[model samples]
Target: MKKILIFFLFFAVLGSGCAQHNAESIYDKDEDRAGTDINRENDGVRRGNGNQDNGMTMTDQNPNLLNTDNQNRHSFSMDVQKAKDVISDAGYEPGSIWINGGEMNVTARLQGLVTRKDREDAQKILQNRLSKALPRYDVKVNIE
Candidate 1:
């Protein structure tokens, strides 16, 4: 009985430690991706014709857009705001837009939430509207 109890306690401690190690590894992986992502965002902002001379780079000004404290909140807010502006200007009424911004990882799942068919249709309208309005951005609308 004594041996069995000791074995169980040891296994429990080992299992817990393994889980903590796994969590730390996941965070480390995200840190790597975040660094790369910030570089790309900064490059895009810099090359936007005259936006680069603002004295600060994109990642320097808005670190949240690159590596977020709360990732879902960060990405969701940015993607939602862009989607709203695009959809609204394309004849969509308020609260009639949904976006499935791409995920950060394989486990992160991509989800496009639309309240109605009208919302989906509005995305199509945005394709035409933004293409004409922001002709320089080369904005391609992919509702998927």
Candidate 2:
């Protein structure tokens, strides 16, 4: 009876430790999986800054769809195309105009150097123009 009790207790302790280890391993795996997601989210911001931090950037991770060359390749909504035309009519060389998820993104070359306030004014003007045209669409402008 004593031997049996000791054996059962030994197994109970061993089994508890194993269970603890199993739980830890599962938690580690979840963390590891989420680790990539966290890094990817940060990467989006870092990369969007045009890799200004001097970090190595991967072109494939983020494509340069803001180029004027590919504008015809992708099918755009009527509002996006209309905004592009408006930008062109405004005498600005538009880079790319894309609309997705009720948002519009515009990249264009504006007058004045990068240091001037005109760049920001240009962005705002373009943003407001699109906003007036597509009231419900979120507009974002980028200068090249």
Candidate 3:
């Protein structure tokens, strides 16, 4: 009876140790994964900054990093086109306008020395036009 009891206790201790080891290994793997993520983030920041030397004008490595060109494609949906017409009618040239059909938000950044009055007028015109064209979406005009 004593031998059997000793054998059971030994097995129980062995099982618990195995469980502890497995838990430690899992914790180590999680730490490794987090470290990798941090390294990747650092690398991205470095890549964005690019290489710079002493006394030289730094050129943009990725000029289109923000994807502005693709986002500002003149060819827009019908709603955005109508909104542009309204701004033009108000005598405010739409320099950079971004429209997301999915988001249903219109963001227009007017480029140039635009007077505050002109901006207000443009906003009024756009609001009217967008209400008529894209009734479901809201338009936000930002002067750049």
Which candidate number has the best lDDT? 2
Candidate 2 lDDT over residue span 1-144, tens digit each: 999999999999999988875565543442355465332355464222254646523432344433344334333456777887878877788888776766788898966666657777877788788788777778888977
Top-down lDDT ranking: 2, 3, 1
lDDT of 1: 0.49
Segments in model 2 whose C-alpha atoms lie over 4 Å from true places: 1-76, 111-114
Candidate 1: segments with Cα more than 4 A from true spot: 1-74, 96-123, 128-144
Q: Give the TM-score of candidate 3.
A: 0.34
Q: State, as a TM-score between 0 and 1, how close model 1 is to the true structure.
A: 0.24
- lDDT, candidate 3, 62-99, per-residue tens: 33234343444333455566767766765566555565
Q: Which model, 1 or 3, shows the larger TM-score? A: 3
Where's the lowest-lDDT run of ten residues in candidate 1?
101-110
Q: Report lDDT (Cα) of residue 76, candidate 2.
A: 45
